[model samples]
Target chain A: MTESVITVEHGAVAYDDRPVLRDVSVRITPGEVVAVLGANGSGKSTLVRAILGLVPLNAGRVTLFGTPQRRFRQWWRIGYVPQRLGAGSGVPATVAEVVASGRLARRGVLRPAGGADRRAVAEALQAVGLTERAGDPVVTLSGGQQQRTLIARALAGQPELLVLDEPTAGVDSASQDAFAEALRGFVAGGRTVLLVAHELGPLAPLITRAVVVHEGTIAHDGAVPEPAGHHATPGHEHVHPHAPDESSGLWGS
Target chain B: MSLFQYDFMIRALVGALVIGLTAPALGIYLVQRRMSLIGDGVGHIALTGVGIGLLLDRSPVLMAVLVSAVAAVAIELIRERGRTPGDVALALMFYGGIAGGVMLVGLSGSRSNANLMAYLFGSLTTTSPQDLTVIVVLAVLVLGTMLVLRPALFAISHDEEYARVSGLPVRALNLLLAVTTAVTVTISMRAVGLLLVSALMVVPVATAQLFSRGFLATMLAAMGIGLVAAGSGVWLAGTIDTALGATIVILAIGIFLVVAVGAAARRALVRRRAVPAGTAAAVEPCDVVLEPAPTSPTPALDLDGPDHAAVPR
Candidate 1:
């Protein structure tokens, strides 16, 4: 850890009149993989979104690299991987083209992408194992591959910190592994990562810290929680260990 | 030389080329933004401008620009409110605009109602020198703005929320697009008429999207298609004694149809050559594919949308 990359103090987000994130405070330092985890409707995504300044804060303040979110214009230093839904949304853009878009913020819209831009794009694609399919239309890729393309698009910017929202959701196991591998390479460069996930799955091992959201507040923060009495099966998928196996119960009582 | 024999023919040809370039040039952005029908909406609003011009004794084209500009801004405002999706807002504005124009035309008590039809059908031999100059200026403005904002526009159109987070001025850029779209619609009304102008804008772009791999490629392809369509349509109309506007739209559509069929055939061929996958993932249950078990007391994180404030990193 070197420098603090993100700081959120008593952050609150509201959708209309209803408060989504009642209160959240998170801080990320350099060379850390911080995972924000919770169940559906727990406001984990909102918390990350609030820090990213994608959602307006109802209360509290957030800073990125010591700059307040509002006046912050240094977007090139931060790379963001939105959910899987961001892929193939509009325009029949190719893998290379979409990846090149990451360079727009760094190079500005007016300047043409030069050698450095192309080099960065190619390197990002290679990191995500997508260099071979760089010429294909994004629409032609599978959901998981599309997700990887987005990750590559983010990585192309060569940001100091990466924020991902459910990057592996809807992705297959293989794709998830690739995402983890690409992220590992990215963070190995002294960068930091902040992500929101329902289940860590393949990403669990990479996480240095975990923050759980429960009812619009931070319920737990520090080491990842495996709930009560849950352990790995060693050779197979880790199953939740419970005495009566009441894990199949529906949500909200 | 023979084709350029008549001065009227020369003017018609010049007008065709202007609309040909501008329509599809702007069309590329409109299509990519999924607001392809915005041309039609603006055109309808231009009709109201024409009616206002007739009543107020002003330049009809200028009036059309003003009216459509206001209309485009109104649409943008509606979009900003996020009360409705773009298509719905455009639809509302479309019918309302035309309705207002029709009433204004009647209320003006002008005997030149037949002349109003000229705006709908377009006159092949009636483009004045003044009209030609206006067309050139309009075309230049549209093209220059597009060139300057090309990258930012592409980012915003691709994903608005992402673009905003990247510190691009999304709202201002969207408004710029709206105003430019209005100018294109009003200017094109002279060559393609209000009813058919959208065809020139949308059809060529749609045709280009069939094979073009990137944004610039698609725009260039669209411009090429538009040039061919406009030139051939005007020539064909002159020879066959038909309406130039309708002819141009029809030609554009014909090209789109050809390209669409070719694209489908290419896709089929590629699919046949590809190897089949081992998994039938589409048949898998939705819960199995997307969700972790709901049983765990650890609350699941929902996928939320992006916020608008620009974050520094």
Candidate 2:
């Protein structure tokens, strides 16, 4: 059997004395697109955060690329796309500039962006179909385009594993298709993906496995669950019954 | 040009240029992190440091740097804990700072309120040769660090979570920024004054954002605006015999207002010209597809059930 890219054994986490995740274990191997699904307040996001060491786990251990997470220093091997754009922090940063930041890990803080870094940034932008808007300030882009810009930033790092938290939460359909296409290209390179999502829209087909989290534990870990009812209909306006809630736990609170 | 003949005037101008260049250079990151007002809080704390220096007969500039650096780190810690609202923590520092400075200065019998006023409103024309030396050394240090760490600083300020996952050392960078901001405040004490130092740090960046489209462009533009404002303000204050710090701040604000009005007017003009063309490009009607509606409401899938799983490859 191939070694897993990510390993979580009996993982648990809590925020402010309130338990958010408990006794959760997941293993992901290379080239697999795994979806983490759950209702609001179900600790799905916390699970991913725990794996990435964003939040402290109360119990259990997590390893990345066969190395213990705490000892893992090879961050350039992983790309992370956060949930949403933070309005660019009221700063005017061009698309290319933001994407170029992804190379900081590989390029180091003191060194300037070399020729290879520039080419990687440019290629990432092109993969997301944002080459035309490379010169525009990120704040000027639409919501979906901003999302694409973020994806381009993650891609610029050239990581083997990509972890995204709801990359399509508020994106438009066209941009979603573009993102899906970008993911298709990423997976074609034998990369791994683990995402936390409420509803898998354009990205549903690419998912190879599913891990369902219901109240801080993994309820099902196998094949992706097929969408039933309105979700099964094409062009049905992607709306899930789960009202966006405080289930985001540490991040939302 | 006659102002150059005076030794004090030349020193003041040199000091002004240094503060002008460094304030906004470091301020850009603070603005990016939405901590623009942090400089103001640090400035207040530096006042307490100045008071301590006056009491102990130590170099005020060095003392202010030390005290303000400590306070700034405390603020960063408080912000990281997130237990208290950022503004509340700043408020505590603001009141405690001014009060401490006043009380300390009072306790020192040799120094009077006039001495405190020099640091409060600035006495640029009285900048001693030693003060200039300190200013130049500290300014170079600040500028060098900012240049070398621009990428990491920009990444952390723009999106901290992403920077952390990238292994860029977010906490250390944040502390470094806090310390840098403190140094900026202390260095500007002789030119823009502690009270108005934040104006130099924030206003120029705000002014530059009006037209800049990228982070580097904004920083360069803000520094340009700062240099121009500081230089002209010093020159004009010498010519008119006005307060140096107030003059510089007012000049920076004047530039901001002019750019703001100009930007608004240009936007209005563009809108007026585009109105006609915009209407002409209205969307044309397209065919609509109708699908059959299901008679019964479909049951929500039981995601927790293993039976609902997709076929395994």
Candidate 3:
């Protein structure tokens, strides 16, 4: 497709001499919507960190857009929504201020934010439907809204690669759907997404390709096989439901 | 009334003002970072300095400042290296410093028990002219440093990883914060004593947090509360001839309670303003609603078209 956006060849990450990921090799093309499916501590998050150069690679190498991992400047083309942004409960920052901080990288050192930065901040706020509550303290928002505010903060940078670690975790059902829909829109608008998600029931349709991470290595890298023994009948709730049709024997396999 | 008033009351007022203003300013960062308990622990660490000063027959303020700075950096280093958070490290440091100080005091042959007791609490009436100058200089320097590093402060406070990734010197900023905390505790020790320095550090910020909408507002409100507590504490201490340190801390706690109640009341009023989404009563209430937000529809793009590639533009 377009130039390879990310290349991880023989990459390994270890924590305290215990291997978290081993000899993983994956190539992500530009404009691709890739979902990394895995259980907790399956190294999906590690892989994301490896790509972002947050983790030191124990084995081979990772390159982003032709630049070596260390040479790349934080992969500014990539956006990140870490697992814990507001883990500090009483931080006393507003949703808008948090979003505005995303622009700090662009507006360095004592320099004030300009019109474009403010507009981007507002647009990012609107993207996650948090414009109405922009002035509210982030601690006061529900869990899902807080997560969305983080997403909007990422959006403020307008990065091409969006890396989210469990963005929908701890969110309510409706908010989960909202997050999925927002991610789907980002992918559809010619941007790339590398999301780590655990829910296969609802997230299958929103993703374009699958990279299943199991036991610190990629198990499968392809289209998801259809759910076994399932049929979509017209006018039923299962009709065109997010999952693929039966016969591929991939559901819970 | 002038900035240069030289009477004992004016000097005490000025000293208290400087200490009060500086403590909360530095305290905001510690509190925001959730290391507020560290402030309490560090206050005890200052006692070790006092004990050392007495043992060596040195200037208590000088020894206190030196020992406090070293202890502050040690706490940070220990916290950074240890897997446990800064709060736990602070507590450990607190006990360690106090134990060391008590042992040192015991080892000394002099009967300096009264000096130790005064240092344990606080004595603002004994604040020397040199102490005032140090407090004023520390306050001004601390505030100036914060102003210079405002951007880095926001970056670290919001998303430390992102800030580090974007090339801000995260570790250096952290060291700066540690130094600020040390200076704040040392200067404030003159006004509130080591025992209640945390009350001086955290109360004003906690009180301001209730009403502040943003960081600047929070800082402003905290400074105002600190000034009020300092002024009222000095006034009461002068009238009653009681301990100024204890008086300032009590006044700050009182303000904290008032602000906490006001914050609760304001929240209740806002909660009442939230009407049914479709009801006409919503028009008369606040313009904002606190309900969950709706999601947007996913956009569809043609992959086979000329614009198939992902571009930020």
The prediction achieving the highest DockQ against the true structure is 2
lDDT of 1 by residue, B124-145 (tens): 5688989988998989999888
TM match of model 1 to true structure: 0.85
Off by over 4 Å in 3: A1-4, A53-56, A170-190, A200-208, A224-253, B1-6, B51-59, B82-92, B102-111, B165-167, B263-313
In candidate 3, what are the lDDT values of residues A5-33, reduced to their tens digit? Answer: 88999999999999999999999887777
Q: How many clashes in each structure?
A: 8, 1, 0
Q: Tell me the TM-score for chain B of model 3.
A: 0.81
Candidate structures ordered by DockQ, highest first: 2, 1, 3
- After superposition, which runs of candidate 1 have C-alpha atoms over 4 Å from their true positions? A1-3, A85-90, A227-253, B1-3, B85-92, B107-110, B265-313
lDDT of 3 by residue, B10-120 (tens): 888988987788788777777877788777777778778877887898876778778888888887787667555865767777898778777766666557576665666
Off by over 4 Å in 2: A229-253, B83-87, B276-313
Of 1 and 3, which scores higher on TM-score? 1
TM-score of each: 0.85, 0.90, 0.79
lDDT of 1 by residue, A172-203 (tens): 78889999999989878878999998678888
Q: What residue pairs clash in candidate 1, if any at all? A: A38-B299, A38-B300, A39-B299, A39-B300, A39-B301, A40-B300, A54-B307, A55-B307
Q: Candidate 2: which pairs clash?
A: A41-A247
Residue A23 CA displacement from its true place in model 1, Å:
1.5
The per-model lDDT (C-alpha) reads: 0.79, 0.86, 0.74
Using lDDT as the measure, the top candidate is 2
Candidate 2 per-residue lDDT over residues A33-120, each given as its tens digit = 9999887778989999899999988999999999999999999999999888764467688899999999997877789888999999
